[model samples]
Target chain A: MNNKITQNLYLLPYALWIVLFVIAPLLLVLYYSFFDIEGHFSLMNYMNFFTPVYMKMAFSSFWYAFLITFISLIFAYPTAYLLTKTRHKQLWLLLIIVPSWINLLLKAYAFLGIFGTKGIANSFLEAIGVGSKQILFTDFSFIFVSVYIFIPFMILPIFNSLNEMNPSLLDAANDLGASKWTTFRRVIFPLTINGVKSGCQVVFIPALSLFMLTRLIAGNRVITLGTAIEQHFLVTRDWGMGSTIAVFLIIIMFLIMSVTGNRKRGV
Target chain B: MSKLVRFFFAIILVSAVLFYTVHELNNSEGYSGRNTLTIYNWGDYIDPQLIKRFEKETGVKVIYETFDSNEAMLTKIEQGGTTYDIAIPSEYMIDKMRKERLLIPLDHSKLPNLHYIDKRFMDLPFDEDNKYSVPYFWGTVGIVYNSKMLGGKKITSWNDLWDSDLRNKILLIDGAREVMGMGLNSLGYSLNDTNHNHLHQAKRKLDLLTPNIKAIVGDESRLLLENEEASIGLVWSGVASEIMSENKNLEYAVPKEGSNLWFDNMVIPKTAKNIKAAHKFINFMLDPKIAAKNAEYVNYSTPNKHALSYMPKGTVNDERFYPSPELTRKLEVYENLGKKNLAYYNELFLEFKMHRK
Candidate 1:
């Protein structure tokens, strides 16, 4: 009984934090979603969300988020795999994480300069005989910047799962006359599937709500659900519609988690 | 280990509680005995020296805060934690705030310097009879183009933006009202047009200009144009002035089709803790010399008629920033379009934005 009391005491702060920050704000958003612009309680915002315009925006936002996550995975998996083989693996991991430690806005500004028409990317293209092109504000620039920002997040989890794997399993596969590719595909991948799922979860949710990158890098060409929410809340002062979108985003997040969530341990 | 963890949690919880208590105590006691005025305005919109002058002149401690947008300022005031003495909002927002009862009706007796304001800027559509708002700075939205890059073609009208030669060379301002206003102006419709058919027609017209548009940007539109990244930009007259100062190749033009005439005004929120100080500050800012200093420093047009004499001859006479009366007649100010109509404008603008190739 005494041990249980101590454990509960230790858990109190975290519980309080979750209640105050996470649960309260979520409840507020849900409450706000039921109202219209005039503060009258109505289902108008929810009804509006189902319209073709918002539906198309939601679909496009999903497509962009999916593309960003997929690209981040493709780049991160190899980088993390190679880093694990390096002698100074932790140092390499530290280097990868160092960029993430910098402010997101600063890194975005750096990309704005680098991908600009007269920037290094275009200058290099010119030197290579491709000539300068409109690199900034394009879909390519947006995806590239997003993938660059999210790669470290994707790699860290996969790196940890790879590190935690038993070396004996790999040796056993080799001893059993299984090729390296077969070992990786059949054994290594399944064990680290949890890591991949978690990594994707970390990247995908934030990617869905990306508002700043859409403006700064994409140059307002792309409109995510987050951008729409920001527009409604700040620009339009239609907090009800913004809240309705938030509620929907939360629902979608839960649906995504269940689909990609860890299953029963053995089965 | 468990004991250590419990100890840490206890420390965190206690510290959080103590922090909250101290913060509350400081807030309550800080203003009770002090002569402080909290003024909320746009970032870098005023001269810091003028603030000091006001403080010294009135012997009131000035607490200055800045917001990037009128909506953000409104949100803060609506949330109602800290009481602000004064706030500056644009014309359309002033109308919205007046309707919401967020503004305090000005006592004309307190603001004796109101007579210094230009008659041209007075009794406008947004706030007729100048009930709550006093004009601070006013400007128009126009095209800022690089002369050398335009291939000897002069940009005189909004129709020039649609030229196929300008394809992928234009950067538009990232604002719903401003961008939508551009569309409406090009279609010979009022910028504040709430007609469903007219707005839709504007959207269709804007859709055709997408191929020429490089991107929609905010403050960075100036930087892009300065570096010659894009040849032309649809920007505010003030931003265009700043850009022109930086890059001599750039020139601003008020399109023949006409565009938005926006004004930023000073007003007191209804929740003002120091109304006397707010009025004093407003009167101080309206003084012709102070107004001219602010105008020159911020590169925006002064709405104070007497301030024009105090300003540089070249800048005051610049037609791009200060359009002639004939051109001014063509321009229209954005009206408060109420709640539902404003949201519709934002929605239509969003649809136009998402229609990218």
Candidate 2:
């Protein structure tokens, strides 16, 4: 009991931090969502959010998030699989994670230089007699950079899951005459479902709120809920409206997590 | 052994926290009982040396703070945790604040150098009588184009943006108000026209230009232009002048059609605790030599008529910085559209931004 009490004491600081920063700020956002700028009690903020324009924005935000999550998964799973199968697995994994050491904003800015009209992408295209094509401010560059920035989040979790896979189970399947692809499909893939689901949650939730990247990389062609909330609070000074949008985003994130996180936990 | 080191770190951390807490509490009590004037302005808008000079001239200690945008400044002032003696907000914001009675009127006696203000900058729509504001810096919205790429062709009118030859080479300012104002001006309409149909028409014209536009940029426009990635960019006169100074191949022109003539004005808020010092500071900034120094430092034009004579010989003659008379006659300053009109513009322009096709 004394040891348990000491361990609990160790957790006290982190618990206090969570309550102060995370829970308190979220509670504040929830409270402000119900009030207008003048401190009047009103549902107009929420009512305004129910419009078709915002509905379309919410749809696009989720679709983009889903697309980015899906793309990151495709790239990550293969890289992770290769990492697990590699001779020097730790070194290869470290190499894959090297890009994450730099900030996302820096990475996005670097991509801007690489894909600019006078940049490497266009220069190479021209060299091949294809002539220059517009790359910056396009949907392609935005999606490309987002995938680049977020692949690590997806990879690290998947790698953890893959690394922990019981090799005996895989060997048993192999001894039973199951081919490599078949064993991966039936045995390895099923056991790693937890990681895949959790990794998707990690990427998808933040992807919905990528406000700055959409502006920097996409050049305003892509407007997510994150950007909408920014426009309301930063540009329009409509904090109530911003909080309302933020509350909706929080709810959507929860809904996505519950659906992904709670299923088949025994695995 | 590690536990002893950790305990030592804990003690040091606690001491640091206590030190800062005591230090901040001391600062809040005022510095040695000296008179302090707090001025809030856009980041890097004023020269630091001028603030020191003002502090030296007057026995007043100056505390300066900065915000990145007008909206942020308004929000900060309204929330009222901190009081600022003076703030330099743009002209349209002055109009909004005047409506809110957030500003206190200036006493002409306290600001005798007000006479040096150019006649053109005086008696404008935002503050016609200069009741609550004093002009600080002014610039015009204009085009900065690569002259080498243009083959010496003069790109004067806003219509040149729609020219097919410049397709995928033109950069528009990412701001909705700036871009929409140009669209309205190109159509020979008022830049401040809040009429619904007129706004939609401007949006329509803006939508058409999307095909030719390479990128809509904020600060990155400078990098893009410098790299020759973008041939022409719609930019502020001050930025254009800076660009021209860097690259001789670039030239700036005020479109034949009108564009925004922006102003940053110094105003004393109603909550100001140092009104007298604020007035003195404003007056000092209006002084010929001081104003010229400020103008040269910030690379923006001075509203003081006498300041021009004190500046570099060709500073006033630089047509890029100061538009020609014909173009100046057509330039329009943005007016503060009230909450309703502002909301409408944001919504419409947001739609335009999202549907960039």
Candidate 3:
């Protein structure tokens, strides 16, 4: 009984933090979602969420998020795989992560300069005879910058999973007369599926809610669920609608986590 | 099933406690000492030296903060979390604050330099009789174009933006009121037009201009124009003035179809803890020499009539930066469209943006 009481006391600060910061804010958001702009309690905001305009925005936002995650995974998987083979693997992995330690806004601003009309990218294109093209404020720049920003997050998990894998499995596959590609496809990939899932989870969810990149890089040509929520809360002072959208986002977050989450019994 | 029921009950109890605690926290008044004054204004709107001067003159520590947009400022002020003594919001937002009773009326006796304010800028519709707001800086929304890049294509009117030759050559300022006003002005309607059919028509009109529009950007619109990324831009007169100084080939024009004339005004919010110091700061800013210096620094048209004498000959006389009185008369000030109509405007603008894809 004394030991049980001591354990409960140890959990006090953490429990209080969860209650005050996490649960409280979430509850407040849920509470705010039921009201209209006039402070009147109503279902109007929820009704508004179902409209075609918002629906289309949500669809496009998901489409962009999917594109960003897929591109990041494609680039990250090979990079992570190669990192495991390098002699100084940890040092190279650390180098890959160093860029991410810089502020996201700073990186976005750097891309703005690099992809500008008179920027290095255009200058190179011109020198190579492709000529300069409108690169900044395009869908390509938006996706490229997003993938660049998220690549580290995607690679770290996959790298860890690859590192944790038994080297004996590869040797065993070789002894069984399997080609390198077959070993990777049949053994390595199936084993590292958890890492890919977690990597995708880390990238896809945040990509869905990316607001600043949409503004700075995409030049407001693209709008995401995050942008819409910011617009409603800050721009329009319609917190009710913002909260409603946020509530839906929370639900979608839970759904995504469950789908990609670790199973009870795992390899 | 019993566990699930218990879990839900615990959630309900926790939420009830949270709501009560939050309510209590909001009601608890923050302690505001006499020597401190907080001022919130738009980013890069004021001269930093002036803030230092104000602090030295008053012996009061100024806690300064900045916001990017009027809506953002309003949302922060309305939350009542911070006790901001002074804020500078544009005309329509002043009107909105007036309705919400978020602002406190000024005591004219405290502001002796009010006489230096331009008669033309006084008693404006947004805050008639200057009850709650003092005019800070005013400008018009117009086109900023590089004549060299345009290749002899003079941009005298909004219709020029729609020219097929100008395809993918224009960058629009990213604001619902400004861009939507462009569409409404092109169609010969009031920018504050609340008619659903009219707004939809404006959106459709903007749709045709999409081919010429390269991007809709905020502050970067000026940079894009400076770099000659786009030949023309829909931007504020102040930004146009600043860019024109950098590149001599650039020129600003208030479109022939008319445009938005915005006045940013300084006011004390209802939550002010240092009203006296706020008034002193306002009076100091209104001084002709100070106003003129601020005008030159920020590159916006000053509302202090007497300050013009203190300003440089070329800057004061430039009709593009300071629109002629006759031209200023034709420009319309944005009115507070109330909460519902303003949200609709934002929605319509979003739809227009989504259509760009």
Candidate 4:
């Protein structure tokens, strides 16, 4: 009882911070979503969210985020699979995660240097006489940088689930004369659905709201939903509209979580 | 099974806490007690020595803070946490604050050095008769080009940006108003053109330049030029000044066709606790030596005619910093286009960004 009480006391500041920072701000956004600029209750903000331009923006943001999530999964899966099979697996996992410790903005700026016209990539291209390429501010650079940034999120959970798989069960499937591909598909893959769900849940939501990448590396060319919210809040000074967009973003994120938050727990 | 579910929750909760805490820490507010002159200005906008001198000379505490954008400054003032005595806002924002009564009328007697303000920089639309704001820095939107790539052709007009030879070599300013204003000026319309049809025409003109364009960017425009990623960029005079200082081959010009002339001005907010100290601070800034020091430190043009001679050795007669009257005749100032039109302009810019083929 005494130990439990001390632990609760230790978490008190964090709990208070969450209430003050997280819960209060979320409630404020929800409140703002239903109002206009004049402090009157209205659905105009929500109504405006469905306008043609906004609808198009929402679709594009989702498409780009989906692309990012899908691409990160493709790259991260094999790496995570390899990690589970490695001798020094812990060290390899540490290496994979260590780069993520660097600041996102710093990494993006460094990439800008690497991707600029006089950058190493372009310099190499010119050295080979393929000619310099306009790679910076292109969609390829934006997605490539995003995939680099978000890959760890896709890898960790999948690693956990793969590492947790019952070796005896795999051996049993092999002993039952199931072919390698078939056993892996019908047995290992289905069992690891929980990990995949958990990983997707981690990666998908933030991919929707990633702003700095869209701005810095993409040259403000890609208008993600997060960028739109920033414009409304800071540039346009429309708190109501920004909040409405944020609310919709939360709804989309929640939907993503639900779809990926596996209900069948006994995987 | 439950452990995985709990693990996912813990991951999200930790990230949420991290993001919220970092954001909060970055924007943590500061307060001033009494007899303090609190001034809010742009980041790295004014020299530290000036703030120290002001404090030392006046026997008053100085609580200085900085914001990066005009909109951010406006948001903080509207939210009303810190009691900022004096704020340096851009002309359009100065106008908005005056209209919104966020600023108080200045007492000219307290500001005796107001006479040192160049007649050319005064009596502007943003603060008519110098009621609310005193010009801090004035500059124009212009082209900064790498002469090495121009091949003996003197690029002197906005049309130069549309040249097919400069394909994917032109970098435009990132802001909605700046980009749309460039489009409007290129079409022989006013930079502050409000007509719906004129805006559409500007958009069409921009679409043609899109093929020749490198990217729409801000802050990094100078780096882009230095890196040779872009041969020419439509950027602010202040940034252009910084660029020329870095790379000798780069040159800046206020296109003959004209461009937006912008000014940052200082004003006393209505929430001022020490209005007298605020006036003293503004007057101190107008002191020729102090104004020169500020201009030298910030690398932006000063509007103090008296301070021109005192400008740091190389900056005074720099044509990029001081345009002739003939050039001034071709320039226009950006006016607050109202909430609806500003939104419309932003939408247009975003649409253009989205449809990048």
How much lDDT does each candidate structure score? 0.91, 0.85, 0.91, 0.86
Tell me, by DockQ, which candidate is best.
1
* Candidate 4 chain A worst ten-residue window by lDDT: A258-267
State the lDDT of candidate 2 residue by residue for B1-357, as single tens digits: 999999999999999999988668547644443488999997767889999898778867789999867877888898788879999999999999999989999998999999999888887888978999999999998899998987876798998888877777788776768888888989999999999999999988888887777767676787778778788999988778776777888988888877888999999997799888899999999999999998888888888899999888788987768766565776777888876677677777777776655
DockQ for candidate 3, C-alpha atoms: 0.51
Model 2: which residue pairs collide? none
Question: How good is model 4 by TM-score?
Answer: 0.86
TM-scores of the models, in the order given: 0.91, 0.85, 0.92, 0.86
Residue A233's lDDT in candidate 3: 88
Give the per-residue lDDT digits (tens) of candidate 4, residues A54-94: 88889878888889889988888888889999999999999
Candidate number with greatest TM-score? 3
Worst 10 residues of 1 chain A by lDDT: A75-84
Interface RMSD of each: 1.0, 2.1, 1.1, 1.7
The local lDDT score (0 to 100) that residue A2 gets in candidate 2 is 100
Q: Which sections of candidate 4 miss by over 4 Å?
A: A1-31, A34-48, A127-129, A265-267, B1-38, B52-64, B107-112, B271-277, B312-314
Worst 10 residues of 2 chain B by lDDT: B25-34
Better of 2 and 4 by TM-score: 4
Ranking 2 against 3 by DockQ, winner: 3
Candidate 3 true-interface contact recovery:
0.67
TM-score of 3: 0.92
C-alpha DockQ of every model: 0.74, 0.44, 0.51, 0.47
lDDT of 2 at B158: 92
